[model samples]
Target: DARVTQTPRHKVTEMGQEVTMRCQPILGHNTVFWYRQTMMQGLELLAYFRNRAPLDDSGMPKDRFSAEMPDATLATLKIQPSEPRDSAVYFCASGLAPRGSGEQYFGPGTRLTVT
Candidate 1:
């Protein structure tokens, strides 16, 4: 199975800045999941509306971050007023089914740093 690809491999920005990560899911996949990773908290789920787990804003800061699948092949995550604490590797997983359903393609990840 092919994997999703993230852009810009790395990003660095100051505090209070905004960061946006784009993910292109595998073709024909109807379900997409957003996630974040940091040394302090491992990997965490951000959002999944059409997913099976029915997870909604699981741990993401609703006021600052957004995850949406605007179209069938594209999904996006935007963080406004990004803080130093928000620095982490963001990625997405895509599959025909929802979270924990089975095989899901993982992205290479977009590294973000808010200085």
Candidate 2:
């Protein structure tokens, strides 16, 4: 019964508030991904990692978004001084796809609302 779990499933914050979200990836999966979905941008990859090591984060806004894997099963994404434009659903996914093609099992996303 392994699956990714996310905390604070829903969040509402005033503009400029710092927000942190946590994810517990499915055991045995080495590759983790962070994604964001908004009305304008359909699900977009923000970061990708293998063995707790970051492989790519080009899609993430360098100034405000950060993603990290501190341990095998734990990953986190943080936004400091979040803005209304940052309001969106953030998702964490994990799977074995190093060969380059595999479907990701997504956790229930964290819905953030900024005003």
Candidate 3:
């Protein structure tokens, strides 16, 4: 009965607009991840956190994108000056691990369209 939840399932904005997506991970889960999907890159991990602390975000564009967990249950992704190339489905997933053997449960996703 545990599930991840994301807000504003769809968004449309002109180029240069800022976009923010939010997620609520399942309670008691210590790990959360953000991923972006596109035809070219397929599915890429943008960021991940454990125990509400960011572990890595090198796959994300440092200048324009950021990921963070402000509290135990909430995670956030933000893009400033969004571009057409940034259009994609962004997913948030949460899981617990025994060093990489656990299953991650994903939220529905936020589909963004940058014009």
In order of listing, the candidates' clash counts read 1, 0, 0
Summarize candidate 2's per-residue lDDT along 1-115 as a digit string, tens digits.
7788998899999999999999988888889999999999899999989999999999999899888898987999999989999999999999986674687889999999999
Compose the digit string of candidate 3's lDDT tens values, residues 1-115.
8899998799999999999999999988889999999989899999999998889988999999988899998999999989999999999999986575588999999999999
Question: Which of 1 and 2 is ahead in TM-score?
Answer: 2
What is the per-residue lDDT of model 1 for residues 1-115, given as tens digits with 9 covering 90 to 100? 6778787689999898878888888877777788889999999988864532335776778889877777777778888989999989987888785344687778999999998
Ordered list by lDDT, greatest first: 3, 2, 1
In lDDT terms, how accurate is model 1? 0.80
Better of 2 and 3 by lDDT: 3
Q: What TM-score fits each model?
A: 0.87, 0.93, 0.95
Best by lDDT: 3
Q: How high is the CA lDDT of each candidate model?
A: 0.80, 0.91, 0.93
Which clashing pairs does model 2 show? none
RMSD of each: 2.8, 1.5, 1.3
Q: Which 10 consecutive positions of candidate 3 have the poorest summed lDDT?
A: 95-104
The lDDT, on a scale of 0 to 1, for candidate 2 is 0.91
